[model samples]
Every structure is written in C-alpha cells, then in structure tokens.
Target: MGSNDSEYFSDEEEAWVMYKDRSEWADITPLPQNDGPNPVVRIAYSDTFTDVYDYFRAVVAKGELSERALQLTEDALHMNTANYTVWQYRRKCLAHLGSDLEKELVFCREMIELNPKNYQVWHHRRVIVEWNGHADKELRLTEIIFSQDAKNYHAWEHRQWVLRTYRLYDGELEYVNRLLEEDVRNNSAWNQRYFVIVQTTGYTQDVIKQEVEYTKKAIEKVVNNESPWSYLRGVLQHSEKGLHSVEGLESWCMALHEAGNNSPFLMAFLIDLAEDTMECHIEEREEKLAKVLEWCESLATEHDKIRREFWRYMARHISHKYSV
Candidate 1:
C-alpha cells in the first residue's frame, strides 16, 4: 500500500490477506529474513510488516524503480517510520519516477504530523522541501507542531532552516514575540529572536539597544526567568561598549539584587557585570572581585544550593584572579 492509502487495514490478518491477493506484486519474488541457526535473539515481526519488508528486500536487491516498489517502501515505512533505509529508498524512487513533488510534500506533512519527533520523517521532509524549493508551508507547519509541543527540537531546527534558507525574515520577530508572550521562559523562542536579529540587520548599535530594552522588559515581567537574562547578556556581548554601555543596566541589576530578587540567574548576571567592570577599570578590580566573591558565596549558601560546589569554585577563581 502507498502512503496515500490511509484507509489500509492495520490488522495483521487483513493485511496478510491483502498482500497475498495483490496480483500487481506477482512479478517480484519476496525475500524472507535470514536468521542464523541457534540465533541468540530473533525479532517477531508482525505478519503485515514481514510481508511488506520481504517484498521490499526483493525489489531493493533487484534494483527495481517501479511504482510497485515505491508503494512497497511506503508500506514498510507505515509499519516502521524510523527505518532510515526505507526512507532513503523512497527518495530514490521519487527521483527516478519523476513523481509529483507537491504530493510527496503532502505525504511528508502527514508523516510528520503522525510522528513529529521522528528524525527520519523530518529529514525526509527537509530533503523533499529542498528539492521542491518551496518553504512557504514550513513556518506554518512548524507553528502547528509547536502548538502541540513547544520544545520539539526537530520542529525548532526545521523552522530555523526554513527561515535561514528562504530569507523569510518578514514578521519572524513578531512570530517569536507571540511565542514569548505565551511563555517567556521558552529558550527556543528567545534563541530564534537572536537568530532573526543576527541574520537580518545584525547587531547594529540601535538594534542592540532595542534588544536590550526588549530583554529588560521581559525580565521585569519575571525576574527569575533565565531566558531573557541569557538573552540580555547575549545582546550586550555584541555591543562595542560592553555591559555598562546600556544605561541604567548596572544600577537596575543592583536594585533587583537589593530588593531580594535573589534568583540564581540574576546573581550570575551581576557577577558577570562585575567581572566586566573589573576588567575595564584596574583601580576597582579588588572591589569588583570582592563583590563577585560575595555573590558566589550567596549562591553557594542560599539562593542556589544545588550548585554549591560550582559557586564555591567561582569564588575561589575570582579571589585567585584578583590576588594574582
């Protein structure tokens, strides 16, 4: 059965009968799997799966690029979507037969919907889309997948590929903004925002300032959220003038720290800023390093006890750096 045969019986009894009765497959001899005598482990494949793969092996060995061979591959994939060899063979058939790529894309979409996290399916979709040179449907498809699963790594990877390859920068920031509005802690959405900025206008001064403000607002909404804090550091890293270049950022961080918003990520950001300050001003190196050591101690003792060893190590490292 082809991938389009959505109504094909999945029952082993019915599928076995269906495969045996098909006259179209009479010309090809089906190859059965060989397990050596006294095999330590033997797989008990379902009847339908066995029949489909037996015929698949036969066609693959004969180097057949016929419609029936293509259908047989689809049948095998329906049984085992994770089979990389079947997907590879299907691509070869599609290429040789000059099949309708648009229809193939639809098939791929259906397969992806069925198995969103399947690496094989996503790779197949990517290859087909690259061949068809139409990435218009990708963003929407990924958005739908994201609605079902926000952190689907495959969907995020595919969406980024589509945006980068097609130069689909228009409204991408808005799309990311909507995602962030739904969940500010989504690191993927925050990363996508960074990607869009870097790929499009780059980190111009104005862009950096705009992103800093955007990240600041996000942090304001949730002081403990790490995504925006990470984004804030990333944006400022691109600035020629470093962390202090962004006006009120240092004082604001101090204010948050003093106000008892003792989030580990907030403390870490402050330590980073203090280190930056120490580097830029040799006279204040001891004082800034002392502040860094203090925060590290706080993290070790109170705010983030899980990483106590890491925080203690940071304190020692800062002390050694200043002393040397």
Candidate 2:
C-alpha cells in the first residue's frame, strides 16, 4: 500500500477513509457488487469494505494497471488476505509497474508473520522470490516461522522449496538436528532430515551407516518412539540392501525384544523383517512363520490388544501363505 499518500487520507483529518471521498477516484464511477435476486445470506459488510471493493471492481473492470490500482489491491488484501483474486491482481500490477520486488518481499514477510499458514501469501512470496532470485532470506524466514510453530506444514513446504530451488543445503542438516534435539518427537523434522539427505548427498553407504547409528541412538533414548524407527526403516528401504545388510539391526531388535521392550513399532519392524526374510530364505520360511505367529499372538493377546483382530488376521494370513 502507498505510504501516507494524500489521496488515501482525509483532507480535514489524518485517518484513511473510503475511496469515494478521495478526489483522485472521483473520475471513476464505483461499481457495486450485484448480489442477484433473493440472496441466501447477505454479508453485513462495513461501509469501508463496501466502498473499497466498489472502487476495486471499477478499477478491475477498466483493466487499469497504475500506481493507484496497485495501492487499491493492497487495501483490498489488507481487509481480506485470503482473497486470491486480489493477490493475483496485485501480482499483475507489480509486474506491469516494474515495482521493486525487494519491497514486495518485505511486504510478503510481514504478511507471513501475521499468518504463516496463509496459502496465498506463501505462493505470492514464492513467486516474488522466483522473480528476484534472492532466496538468502527465505531460510531465516522459515526458521523464524518454525520456531513459532514447528509442525506448520506450509512453513515446512516453503522451506523445502526454498532449499531445493536455491540449493541452500549447506546448513540444513544442522538445522534439522537442532530441531530434532529440541523435540525428538517432531516427526516433521525427522522427515525433513530424510528429504535433505536424499536431495543433497543421497543415501550413500557411509550416509546410511551414519543414519542407522543415528536412528539407533534415537530409539535407544526412547524405546517407544515411532519417528526414528520409521526413519530407520526408510533408510533401509532406500538402501535396497535388505535387513541383513545392516548387520546388527536384526540382532539389536532381538536384544530389545529379549529385554522385554514390547513396543508396537518395534514389533511391527520385526514382523516386517521376518516377512522379508521369509521371502529371501525359503528354507527358513517355517521358522520365520513361527516367529511371526508368536509375535502376532503376543500382540493380539498382550501388547497391542486394541488391534487384536488385525493381528489375528495377520497371523492367519501368514500361516496360510506359508502353509505353516
């Protein structure tokens, strides 16, 4: 919006008022919105909103792309930020007028601060950044947003786009580590770690080894935590090397199981490993089926009784599949 422009301010006072009172808009006739006959529910629009939108319609109908038109869009947006049509018009004005995209970025940052989850505002910011090619501040903006709400999906998505588009992967791992340290249960951070790894260095052997060790430490810290276990499984899957490739994973799970840790995720992981083993080693199909049945029975009768029927069904299916 224009800063302290006399056209927006009343002559006698300093307050911004309706566009009808502005001398600059006097030449254009305001076009009021038609509600059609017998509206279902008439919106009780304030006079200011009614007047602003009336002038907005006039300007849009005329297809005006001037400074005043830009300011008018800003006014409409301030009242209703979610109005995607207003945002689109504003972008057109910005491009037609060759407005300073840097200032536009600042405006978008302010909008994000007010409502980080606003989809249109984020899309506008992305478009501006794409045009300006200045994504240096995007990371910090997303970090600030994440600090406020770590699980904000929009912020995470925006950060990923910025990072991937700008190749800003230098400190992303450390950033993810910091977030994970702050809250180990933050599944978003765990997923972000996977994304950063896959996008940048990929799941190389050394990277897989580091991730496996990382997941082990994380799971050891909290036996019942599901995030790290899921990450571990994802890492193994991406490696395409199967469970045996991890060397100590199966034994580690067995050790945890022997120590009386009956976490459902742990059991699920073991079941998956056993199923994989059954496919790879036909000789051990009977033995693996027995182990699977034991665990499924244990889960149905003891640990995860709420899913008893599901587990029982699994037991039946596994037994029938292998003729155990």
Candidate 3:
C-alpha cells in the first residue's frame, strides 16, 4: 500500500472502525476535485496536525483561497487540542478578520475549556473578553479564571492590566478587600492590591497596616527562612507604607533568628539588601545591621563563616560616618 493507503481506505463507515479508539485519526477519503484553477495536488500525507496545518497554510496563502483553510485549521484543533501552533495561526487568522471576531472569541473559549492549564489559552481568552465585554466584562472574565485558579499569575496580571489600562479603580479598594477575605496571603494578589491602593488612593496609615499584616501573613506561610527574607525584600522595595517600621524590621529579624540567623540564605539576603542600599546610608543601616549581626551570634559553630562575615561587615559599617 502507498502512503495514501489509509486515506483511500478511510470512508465514514470504516473511519469509525479505524479511529473509534483514536480520535486524532482523520478520515481523508478523497472527494471529487472541484475542477478549479491551480487544483490542489493529491499528495499522500499523514493525518497529524502538523501536516494538516502546513497544508492549510500553504493553501490559505494562495490567492483568494476558499474557506477550506479555516475549516482545516478547525479540524486540526479537533484532532489535537495541544497543538499550540495551530492555536497561534488560528489567532492570527481571526485577528485579521473583522467579521470573524465573535467566532474567534468562541474558538478561544473552546480552547480554554479544552485545556484550562494552558497559560496561552487564558491569555487568548483575556483578549476575547476585552473585545467582547462591555465596561466591566473584562473583570468578569478575570474573576472566572481566578475562581478556577486563585494562584494564576497570568490571570492576576491580566486583571491588573485591565484595571490600570481602563483606570477602573473606583472599585479597587473593594477588590483588595475581597482578596484579603478570600486567600489572605496570595502574594500576587497582595502585590496587585498594593499597586492599586497606592496608585488609586495614595499611601496612608491604613495602607501601612494592611502591608504589615500582609507581611506577617506572608511570613507565616513560609516553613523556611527563605520566604521571610523574600517577603522582607518585597516590603523594602515598596516602602511607601511603613513596611520598614521597627515592628516590621523586628519581625524580619526574628525570621532570620529562627533560621539560625547565619544560614547562608539569611547572609545572602542581608548582603543583597545592603548592596541595594546607597553608600550614603551605610551608617544609617548600621543599627539594623547590628541587630541582624546579634541575631547571627546564636548560630552553631559549623555556621561560623557566614556569621563572622556578616558580623565583621556590620562592625565596619558602624565605624563609618556615611549618613543617610
């Protein structure tokens, strides 16, 4: 049998028998040629998505081709939902067609139903929601995704973009409140809340309270020292609120203390934090550095190298007059 053997043998009746257990197999029983110009060559090919997608694209690029290209792409997706290239080309084709926008959105929604874990599909769904929905439709779409996966960064980022791009923060404070009530320690959600709160309402004492509480909650989520160190860096980066407060700093120090203070992770965080600080504030940081160094002293003898290095660095900083 030739390579076209399966194609010739597969009729609707036989297709079910050959492909009942293999849905990806296409019944390519040849139809009568339409007797049109540049008639398609009847080349034997596999039923794989890649082969069909390539053939569809080739025919689509031909001048004023028929709707068969779109049909072929759809067929390819039906055969293999995981074919990202097929989805990509379909997106491009839909984007260029003014009338097919709704159809495109429906197709993307189908893609999401097929594979909810696909970040790319979620992204495409976002685009469709933005185009199809009215004033608050995008937010509704975002809510749908978050409900399915509260930790989805793609969905979170998309929500942020929708709000910021549309300046839809009249409800932002409400949004932050909802997140706090729901997950309490979702860092991505917290970060978005921080951005929305600061930009929409400006930093205030209330903002400080929330961030402090968030930091505490974030610290609790960590079973190791690294998370607290990571959380502290986030606080330091966005200190519009009083995240660098004495209480917050102490909490951070306590986290390191519990991790043996001089664990390589603690030392690395401190060193990195110091590097990010300005030389002019080297003296100003000495007090906190001393506090950290004191905490480091409790480390076991085996951890001496990290403990000694940080202690020496703090001592040298205390001796300097560099002021903030």
Judged by TM-score, which candidate is best? 1
Q: Which pairs of residues collide in candidate 2? A: none
Q: lDDT: which candidate is best?
A: 2
Residues 1-324 of candidate 1: C-alpha lDDT, one tens digit per residue: 334234345444443554555898788778888887877888766666678788888899999998888887877887788889999999999999999999999899988988899999999999999999889899999999999999999999999999889988899999999999999999999999999999999998899888888888899899999999888888888988888778899999899889989999999999988888877788898788878988999999999999999999999887887753
Q: Using Cα atoms with residue i matched to residue i, what is each candidate's TM-score against the true structure? A: 0.93, 0.91, 0.57
Counted clashes in each candidate structure: 0, 0, 0
Error of 2 at 66 (Å): 1.7
| Alpha-carbon shift of residue 276 in model 3 (angstroms) | 13
Q: Which lDDT tens digits does candidate 2 get at residues 1-324? A: 222223333453447757998899999999998999999998877677788888999999999999999999887877777889899999999999999999999989988887788899999999999999779899999989998999989899999999888888998899899998898889999999999999998998888888998988888888899999999988987667766667889999989999989998899889988998888889989889989999999999998999999999999998888853
Stretches off by above 4 angstroms in model 1 are 1-18
Task: Tell me each candidate's RMSD, in Å, in order.
Answer: 2.9, 4.1, 8.9
Candidate 2 has an lDDT of 0.88
Q: Model 2 clash tally?
A: 0
TM-score for predicted model 3 compared with the true structure: 0.57
Instruction: Show model 3 residue runs off by greater than 4 Å.
Output: 1-46, 63-66, 78-92, 95-97, 117-119, 126-135, 170-185, 217-291, 297-324
User: Which clashing pairs does model 3 show?
Assistant: none
